[model samples]
Target: MDTGASEVAHDFRPFFRVYKDGRVEKYKLIDHVRPVPAGLDPATGIETKDVVVSPETGVSARIFARTAGGGGGGPDRKLPLLVHYHGGGFCAGSPFDSTSNGFLSAMVTQANVVAISIDYRLAPENPLPIAYEDSFAALKWIAGHSDGSGPEPWLNQYADLGRVFIVGESAGANIGQYVAVRAGVAGIRVKGMLVVHPFFGGKETDEMYKFMCPTSSGLDDDPKLNPAVDPDLPKMACEKVLVCVAEKDWLRNRGVKYYEALCGSGWEGKAELVEAKEEAHCFHLFTKSERAEQLIKKMVDFITMD
Candidate 1:
């Protein structure tokens, strides 16, 4: 009897399925950094200028303003803004790290708008809510007026509140989605959201057992690293979501679930699930990957598309 089940297991890269003692075991690898090329520097490639968004929180961030083709725009020309958050499993990385499309620099150039990359407080030392609170505050600050403590030159020159976008990666994407959900509650309607490999939901399900094999689950086994949160957020609140998922990445399922949840929740937001056919999470960090270029181009098209 086939029983709608397969006796043959699938093994790709570090992922493998082992059936023994009337039980099936699944193995997945995490904690290893994907190899990105050396020449591509998403972090230091863009010309970064400093700015401050809040004095109360003492938050400092960089404002990357994309130069309109031919470098001719003065401060008066208003442009859309993408508030970017970098990936590091919520513990490592920065906005300057993935400077291409999802990062501040990339969003600036790709979206052809101002990119405000928020440097929120990290976890363990800061822990839950701190990162979330800081990110939300930054968005609010941008929508509102700037305080005196922030960088005057950058704020005065770049940044326009009318056209605002929110973007993030890994744990940062976690924060981005949370912000979008709350933004709706607070009457803050952002132009769009770019979520790359975001981690969502905290409760463990029966299927997770297979994915979390004793020795192969890796960092995902650690709650702090892949922490779970309240799952009651209203989906589709974000104006538009550019959901980028990697085929070989362990986080692929979670990203897909989040995307489906958004649509299921009845959000009018537009969505495009871009599968990096041969890539994995944070593959964009590797500049030389052919797939990386495809990912960046797609992201730019998503954000800038009229």
Candidate 2:
């Protein structure tokens, strides 16, 4: 006789697990000591609200904006609307989590733009392209507010439709890039793309792309996972792009390579690269180091620059 314990097929602890029976269980990296509610963040004045993005798919997102209102009321002066996606390897992570809350609060306060942090469907249960689809759907919902008759009040009241930006970190960056590339077809015009410590370049064994999307041929060829290789790289529908990388992170080179590829692709958009010395992936969220503050400063400048 055999024990009832299910054998593990792929063990990616602190993130997820795949059992021989095809079951996937994800583990949170850290337990919430005290749950953060949706409202004003004390340190930063950014207010957040959870809203239903899609009724049919049960897709929701956390909206970040200043209660006092931000730029866009005139033709010459308009605040950029930022659509952010969080980094979690496409398996786990949340926009409302404490870490995410802290970072986004600071970001919103500094940049003074209405932000929508997407909480897309996770993988193993939802699988690859689901997160991508959910994100695009969120963008479409944001676009719905362009005519000032959308469902959400905050977006209709404050968000500037003419100025839109896409921001993502790590795996979320991959998702953001995927959406930005496809936004043109959907008639979604974006002003800029901010990709921070993006996820690209992985090996065959326990590969991230293969695990998330079994249909992928490999990490190198998949356009969704590696935007650097996508033939549509030149067609990215954005006026500007900011690619951030940490010198110490393993994926730093990939970010650099992406910037080079974008510049070489004849995309006709101004692309800038910033590498934080001695920093790790998504370090701006975890530490108060000088480098972290500098990164935030750079990000603010990028968003607010005319």
Highest lDDT against the true fold, candidate: 2
Q: Kindly report which residue stretches of model 1 are placed more than 4 angstroms away from their true locations once superposed.
A: 1-46, 66-76, 96-103, 146-153, 202-232, 235-237
Q: In order, what lDDT does every prediction score?
A: 0.61, 0.82
> 18-94, model 2: which lDDT tens digit per residue?
77767777777766523467987656766789999988989899988777434323333435688999888888788
User: After superposition, which runs of candidate 2 have C-alpha atoms over 4 Å from their true positions?
Assistant: 1-4, 31-35, 68-78, 202-206
Question: Over the stretch 121-215, how does candidate 1's per-residue lDDT look in tens digits?
Answer: 75434445577788888877766633323335544456555567787877778788777777777887687788897765434532322243232
Model 1 scores what on Cα lDDT?
0.61
Q: Which window of 10 residues has the lowest lDDT sum in candidate 2?
A: 69-78
User: What's the lDDT for candidate 2?
Assistant: 0.82
